[model samples]
Target: MGKQMTEMLKGTLEGIVLAILSVRPAYGYEITARLREQGFADIAEGTVYALLVRIERNGLVGVEKVPSEKGPPRKVYSLNVPGREYLEEFWTTWGFLADRLGQLKEEGK
Candidate 1:
């Protein structure tokens, strides 16, 4: 990703992750992998981990430690009620921005 896209992703990464969890519960690596599958190829695992920590601290996600065959227990995250509510708000805000930005882009052209 270019610097501008990277910067933009930073702003939206939290919502993106929450949106991912809204689909299903997943561990950190799985979340990162899903992001890659969705075209966020440049997102670092460490970035996702850090964001996970933040959201977990904020009580936006409910986590469970499940045994991992490869290493220590994995912390699988699920979107709780609060998380879902936040995700809904995120989508609303995103829609508002998208509409405005779309208008601006057309105006510029």
Candidate 2:
């Protein structure tokens, strides 16, 4: 990815991960795979885990330990009420920024 994309992701990854959890509960590996499938090819697993830790610490998500066939147990995360609220705010903020940036791009064109 380009430097600009990388920089943008640094600010947006948390919201992106929250949006994913809002859709459904998933474990760390599942979240990473989903991000990759969604075109976040440059995202690292460590980055996602770190973001998960932060959100969990912030009380945005609830974690449950579920038995995994391939492992001892897997920690699955689901979006709590606070997480849903946060995601709504994220979308609103993202929309405003995107609209202003779009205007800038059009002006440049």
Q: Which ten residues in a row have the lowest lDDT in candidate 2?
A: 2-11
Per-residue lDDT tens digits for candidate 1, residues 1-109, read: 7999898986599999999899989999999999999999999999999999999999999999999899889999999999999999999989999999999999998
lDDT of each: 0.93, 0.92
lDDT of 1: 0.93
For model 2, state the Cα shift of residue 72 in Å.
4.0
RMSD of each: 0.9, 1.0
Tell me the tens digit of each residue's lDDT in model 2 across 1-109: 7889889987699999999899899989899999999988988899889988999999999999999889678889999999999999999999999999999999998
Q: Each model's TM-score?
A: 0.95, 0.95
Q: Assess candidate 1 and give its TM-score to the true structure.
A: 0.95
Q: Which 10 consecutive positions of candidate 1 have the poorest summed lDDT?
A: 2-11
Cα error, residue 106 of model 2, in Å, equals 0.7
> CA lDDT of 46 in candidate 1?
97
